[model samples]
Target: MSTTSTEPARRAGWRTETFARLDERLDRVLGATAKEFEKLRVRTVGDLMLHVPRRYFSGTELSDLSQLRVGEEVAVLARVLRTDVHQGHGGRSARGGMNSRLTSVISDDHGRLELTFFGKPQVMDYWRRQLTPGARGIFAGKVGEFRGTRQLTHPDFVILGDHGEIVGGAKRNAVLAEVTRQPLIGLYPATAKLRTWTIAQSVGLALDQLAGLPDPLPAAVRRQARVIGLEQAYRAVHQPQSKDEIDGGRERLRFDEAFALQLTMARRRADAKAHGAIPRVRRDGGLLAAFDARLPFTLTAGQVEVSEQLMSELARPQPMQRLLQGEVGSGKTIVALRAMLAVVDAGGQAALLAPTEVLATQHYQTVLKLLGDLAGGGLLAGAGPSTDVVLLTGSMPVAQKRAVKLKAAAGEAGIVIGTHALLGEGVQFADLGLVVVDEQHRFGVEQRAALSAKAAAQPHVLVMTATPIPRSVAMTVFGDLEVSTLKEVPAGRADVGTVVVDAKNHPGWVERAWQRVIEEVGAGRQAYVVCARISSQPKRKSTDAYAEDLDTDPGGEDIEPAAAAVDVYAELSGGPLKDLRVDLLHGQLSSEEKDAAMSRFASGETDVLVATTVVEVGVDVPNASMMVILDADRFGISQLHQLRGRIGRGGHPGVCLLLTKTAAGTTARDRLDAVASTRDGFVLADVDLEQRREGDVLGASQSGGRSSLRLLRVLDDADLIAEAREIAEACVAADPELIDPGLSDIVTHVERQAAGDWLERT
Candidate 1:
């Protein structure tokens, strides 16, 4: 009792005194430059200190300028070889009436680069004098090429003396000295509005004002983990003397991020255990058992094992927070269905939230077909003890939606499945015992919380994703939730063969791909034609699945837009596969139109379904054995894997053609080749993680905020994350309430930053 009483006083004292310096506003320290710093989101002294340099340049080392790629932002130190000023076009005023140009040639040890600036005569003369022959300085800008010559147009630069000292006026030297004084010059992430030297000066000012930094990690944990303290880390990261110091500082900070995250997760788990949960124990001869007995096929051993784990956890009086990830078509839906039925049998309701309307509707149909008479809920003749299944979507008619809400509120609907509409108004549940989220990554924390709020008590949550996550990602991102993996695909599932149709080198391959689709249709099988967009309109946004796959012209070169479903459907239905029946489906289409297209394809009434990635997940058609993806290079690796998973589910072997205009030996083509080479989702998952920033993997994109993890890499720091998790669990076991003020503050800060998504608060 005395310990509890002192905890509040200790926390208050720490907040008021220990962290006061960190909480100080940047304006107090940085004076006028604070406004510029604020543009980078460094509003506080602590934020400024934590803004570590992205990379460092060594005064003793020089990089090969020849290797620099176009479109890359670079900071290079070079000596000016020559300078010239040209007036207008070929020394005469042409277009725009102000075409004076200042050009200079700069070179390092390896290669030469050209610099150009276009302005009025005064501006050109000023630049010409600044970039005279023999001048050595650091030039930074986006690498551009003109007439096959590497160049930086109107780049940011700082001249340096022979002794590596910045050569400038008193005020200029003062700002850049904080950045150039060390043996290793740090290159920070700078923007067009704020240069690197100004940010360094701001950091220096903030650092000088910081009186002290309280370490969040306990001394013993630091010793065990072999990491430095917070103060040393800040100094080493921002003003390092050597690369080794940079390494040490980065590791320590990464551990801080991991430890804070793990502690939050552990505390959440403990709090969840402390709460009272209604037990959803499965009973004998219940809906689950009855359904299982009538199944024509046997469950895989992996499925059976995962099912038992879920059943055991659900039977307990603690809310179940489990993440079920498996290979595509590995039967995660079956396992989730069994758990939902267990909750229904325990006199409760279950809700399945899908990311897309198509998936929700497909799940509704799949459940009905699987249950047959067991879903009658006493409304049908010769039905046993059963319950009703309802599908609620935003596109549903008002009457239909109202009926679903009434059934859900009255506890008549044993299972509820819907899109985001289920989280909207007037959706109540009599006894919500479980929630099953499909493609869990697509939904954010607030949406989950809203559904949980509908329950009288915290409902058991089972999130299922078809995109197989690497173990390291599973630990780092979903640490608070228990993860169950299913790797085995059910027996009799046919093999899927992937082929890359390079349209750039082999233009005929495009026609051949269409021919293959026609042949599959001729064989009494349906096919899918996937596109990156709905239409070619410039203002229309890409579908959610292909949102990140939009074409980017970094080199300022003309490039064609990605293939669109509407255009492709028109072309195929009129030109290549004109004899076959084809229907278009995309996000822009009305719900009724989309549903009709899917229905036609599923029932074999449509020979080909041309659509965007709306069918990326959970749209199953056994007879659809072929898929041809147009401009497949635009899609991500995991997305490509998920898209192909639609085919190959039936007993017949499947064929997937990836048509791309990307040339060979390019990054885009390599990604497509990797997807075509193997079908292992786990392997592809690791590759995907390696290619993407850790922030995206941790749901920072969904939350629309900076990533909670600034220094930690979910891929490279796997072992560090594992060790931190172990130490955090031990710390939580010792102090379940996180009474230590410093540690508690760290957890709170991380949670606040990632409030909407990353941590998934209990």
Candidate 2:
């Protein structure tokens, strides 16, 4: 094709050209100060061009001054008729005169308006010079009435003519011409000193250099995807002449982002397939069969299906990169145990990584209880091969931790469970076959890779998460990993009833909430009173002793402190619920204290556990049927869902009362209402994604500074992502290594996106 020959040259030119050549520097192009330019962070012409507008403003609808409402914002082009400086009528100051302000009168053909600015003498003089008699310019601001006259207070004005040593009048006229020619005005994200006008001017200069830029996407692929050329996209996004052009440009950019991400995922999958892993296949299901026989309940069909999928992956010589997602009480723990048993049966060690020490201990205890007979030295002692399970945490006694580590190093521990302590040095495994990461989102990609690197042979990875992810988010965020969903809860589990209690609407809601907790406790059911903060401290007096004399202190001595877990625990134990057993738990407590508190709560000795979100995961108590979350508006949607999931695990129905000070018709109220309406985590996940921006979903540790995705929205651009994924699959299938010259830029972009991630070494 004719386009092929010139494309390389264009690409080379764009890569080599500097911002200086394109006149896009703040100082040279927009007359900005050095400090202001430092805040812009635009280095090259490419960077300037990529700084797209946050929103657009229309310049075509210029309103006449006579038609402007008192509170409405309007724009007008007018000629200055007079400028005057007048002193205020207030009492004389220590400098022997009151403050002064500069006032200017400007008029259009039909009406006139006054502009006022109050400031120091030098600043007022500067404005007085700019608004000299007969000066013409554009002014935009809110219209206000000042003593029967329509006026604009400190309006944003752009002088239309050339001043002493500045640019010529012709250049000013050209800027005005460009502004009038465009259908919309671009409002860019800017710093305090670098306004939108400065950014627009710099972008205008950069657009002129688009002719020599290369399209990151190949021509055939672009045509197939129906995306605009990269050069045209840059032009239209920065300087669009029509709405259609803007839409096309935005779509192309979104596609480019999504395609790049999918390409990276595709390459990762291919590379993972190329690597060799030790097949963890076990012919004898002796230990697994025995473990399942001891279970109190039967496995759900969804769990069985997912277990089969995991077994199949474990039998392969390639590493299994799978994500197991389910709602709370979805039997994910049992499924993970089954996978671990498979590896153990194959004469290999399996490691279970938990995000917190409490969770690690919980898993260790649950596994110990489940493996009652088959756990050597038990009732079913000689029924099957004995499997040794060891627990490692940061706070374990030194001698005990050393014993656990020795067992792990010698391959004596068939299944090792621990928190981040497992990632420390000297924590080696004899032969790690499978790694199950619980609460996968709590760990970073680097930590996952570190665990994988612990073994000589590649290990099968099964990442488990209780937070439900929407289908669209999973496709984009976890695109490289195969997913298995466990939607069905085990039989006999009761659904939880959630209600939102507005403290603002009901005057006695707080007392009623406490009474409800008391009722639940009196009925022989435990309660969890969750608080946002661990402790509440009294407000200290002002630091400046002279603040009161100067009348500068904003007093808050009369305001009561917010309720904390400790405060609430003390109150319930000594005051209202004095007869009941109450305990406090938080992250600040020592490991032994935490363990004690949890043990008491689990054993039904503590009637109420006032804790923070540390109890959000893995602290299952069947007797605790009621939970009251104070300041529920402060918690995120997914977090609220997870906290509520801690209840209703037993056969009895659970109740979750969400207490909020937020009023009706607020966003916080809406979020609480959504959570109260349905127990479906998938629905709430969609709402969560909608509320927040698509962040570093892969893991925030991998992304250095910039976000993984820029223009693509996982929720809104699902269709585009799907299409790009299809094309990316084909592209990677054709060129697994991405060696084609046409994909060189794309390859580089992906590498940059990966940063120092473990995949970079691969």
Best by TM-score: 1
221-300 per-residue lDDT for model 2 (tens digits): 89889999877888788888877888899888888878877886776677667767788885575678778777888899
List RMSD in Å for every model shown.
4.6, 8.7
What TM-score would every model get versus the actual structure? Answer: 0.89, 0.79
- Cα lDDT, all candidates: 0.80, 0.74
Per-residue lDDT tens digits for candidate 1, residues 1-762, read: 012112223444445243567778888887777787765677788777778887787654454687666665677778889999988643445544667888899988689999988777877777787788988788888888899999998888877776677774213566676577777887776655677777777777777776476676778889988999888888888888888999999888888878877776776666667666789989887888899999989999999999999999999888898999999999999999999988898888999999889999999999999999889874211146588999999999999999999989988899999998988879999889998989987766546666877888878889999988888878877787899999999998899999999788898888888898888888888899999878876543323322332333433344567888889999999999999999988887778888888888888899999999999999999998999998898777878999999998898899999998877776667778889999999988887777655644566333223355667888888898899889888888988888777677766655555543434432
In model 2, pairs of residues that clash are none
Point out the worst 10-residue segment of candidate 1 by lDDT: 1-10
lDDT of 1 at 633: 81
Q: What is the lDDT for 147 in model 2?
A: 92
CA lDDT, candidate 1, residue 405: 98
What is the TM-score of candidate 1?
0.89
Indicate which candidate wins on lDDT.
1
